[model samples]
Target: MSRTAAQFKLRMPAALRAQVEQAAKEARRSLNAEIVLRLEASFAQVKQEVSQ
Candidate 1:
Protein backbone atom coordinates (compact mmCIF):
# COMPACT_ATOMS: atom_id res chain seq x y z
CA MET A 1 0.00 0.00 0.00
CA SER A 2 1.07 3.53 -0.73
CA ARG A 3 1.92 5.98 2.05
CA THR A 4 -0.32 8.42 0.23
CA ALA A 5 -3.82 7.04 0.51
CA ALA A 6 -7.27 8.50 0.44
CA GLN A 7 -8.80 9.41 3.78
CA PHE A 8 -12.28 8.43 4.84
CA LYS A 9 -14.36 9.46 7.83
CA LEU A 10 -16.19 6.64 9.56
CA ARG A 11 -18.57 6.65 12.50
CA MET A 12 -19.16 3.50 14.51
CA PRO A 13 -20.35 2.50 17.94
CA ALA A 14 -17.85 2.94 20.76
CA ALA A 15 -18.08 -0.78 21.57
CA LEU A 16 -17.19 -1.69 18.01
CA ARG A 17 -14.31 0.77 17.96
CA ALA A 18 -12.98 -0.67 21.19
CA GLN A 19 -13.20 -4.18 19.80
CA VAL A 20 -11.30 -3.18 16.67
CA GLU A 21 -8.70 -1.36 18.74
CA GLN A 22 -8.14 -4.45 20.85
CA ALA A 23 -7.86 -6.64 17.79
CA ALA A 24 -5.43 -4.22 16.18
CA LYS A 25 -3.25 -4.20 19.29
CA GLU A 26 -3.24 -7.98 19.48
CA ALA A 27 -2.40 -8.26 15.78
CA ARG A 28 0.37 -5.65 16.05
CA ARG A 29 -1.12 -3.51 13.28
CA SER A 30 -2.41 0.03 13.18
CA LEU A 31 -6.18 0.54 13.51
CA ASN A 32 -6.39 1.75 9.92
CA ALA A 33 -4.58 -1.35 8.66
CA GLU A 34 -6.81 -3.68 10.62
CA ILE A 35 -9.92 -2.00 9.29
CA VAL A 36 -8.60 -2.11 5.72
CA LEU A 37 -7.68 -5.77 6.04
CA ARG A 38 -11.18 -6.60 7.27
CA LEU A 39 -12.90 -4.55 4.60
CA GLU A 40 -10.84 -6.19 1.85
CA ALA A 41 -11.67 -9.63 3.20
CA SER A 42 -15.34 -8.75 3.28
CA PHE A 43 -15.29 -7.75 -0.39
CA ALA A 44 -13.56 -11.02 -1.32
CA GLN A 45 -16.08 -12.99 0.72
CA VAL A 46 -19.01 -11.24 -0.92
CA LYS A 47 -17.60 -11.89 -4.36
CA GLN A 48 -17.21 -15.57 -3.57
CA GLU A 49 -20.72 -15.73 -2.24
CA VAL A 50 -22.12 -14.09 -5.34
CA SER A 51 -20.24 -16.50 -7.61
CA GLN A 52 -21.43 -19.56 -5.71
Candidate 2:
Protein backbone atom coordinates (compact mmCIF):
# COMPACT_ATOMS: atom_id res chain seq x y z
CA MET A 1 0.00 0.00 0.00
CA SER A 2 1.18 3.50 -0.75
CA ARG A 3 1.60 5.72 2.30
CA THR A 4 0.91 9.40 2.56
CA ALA A 5 3.39 11.31 4.70
CA ALA A 6 2.10 13.87 7.16
CA GLN A 7 2.89 15.29 10.55
CA PHE A 8 0.54 15.93 13.47
CA LYS A 9 0.62 16.33 17.20
CA LEU A 10 -1.24 14.17 19.69
CA ARG A 11 -1.68 14.48 23.43
CA MET A 12 -2.03 11.31 25.44
CA PRO A 13 -2.46 10.46 29.08
CA ALA A 14 0.83 9.69 30.88
CA ALA A 15 -0.11 6.06 31.39
CA LEU A 16 -0.89 5.62 27.72
CA ARG A 17 2.37 7.29 26.79
CA ALA A 18 4.28 4.82 28.94
CA GLN A 19 2.47 1.91 27.30
CA VAL A 20 3.30 3.16 23.83
CA GLU A 21 6.92 3.67 24.77
CA GLN A 22 7.20 0.12 26.06
CA ALA A 23 5.57 -1.35 23.00
CA ALA A 24 7.77 0.68 20.69
CA LYS A 25 10.89 -0.54 22.47
CA GLU A 26 9.78 -4.16 22.29
CA ALA A 27 8.83 -3.86 18.63
CA ARG A 28 12.10 -2.06 17.76
CA ARG A 29 10.16 0.83 16.23
CA SER A 30 10.29 4.55 16.79
CA LEU A 31 7.59 6.01 19.05
CA ASN A 32 6.08 7.81 16.07
CA ALA A 33 5.95 4.64 14.00
CA GLU A 34 4.34 2.75 16.88
CA ILE A 35 1.64 5.40 17.26
CA VAL A 36 0.97 5.50 13.51
CA LEU A 37 0.70 1.71 13.33
CA ARG A 38 -1.80 1.76 16.17
CA LEU A 39 -3.91 4.49 14.57
CA GLU A 40 -3.95 2.68 11.22
CA ALA A 41 -5.01 -0.56 12.90
CA SER A 42 -7.79 1.23 14.75
CA PHE A 43 -9.05 2.82 11.56
CA ALA A 44 -9.04 -0.54 9.79
CA GLN A 45 -11.04 -2.13 12.59
CA VAL A 46 -13.63 0.64 12.52
CA LYS A 47 -13.95 0.38 8.76
CA GLN A 48 -14.56 -3.35 9.00
CA GLU A 49 -17.20 -2.84 11.67
CA VAL A 50 -18.96 -0.21 9.64
CA SER A 51 -18.95 -2.39 6.51
CA GLN A 52 -20.44 -5.26 8.44
Best candidate per lDDT, number? 1
Q: Each candidate: how many clashes? A: 0, 0
Per-residue lDDT tens digits of candidate 2, residues 1-52?
Answer: 2257766688989999999999999999989889889999999999999999
Q: What is the TM-score of each candidate against the true structure?
A: 0.89, 0.79
**lDDT tens per residue, model 1, 1-52:** 5778988799999999999999999999999999999999999999999999
lDDT of 2: 0.91
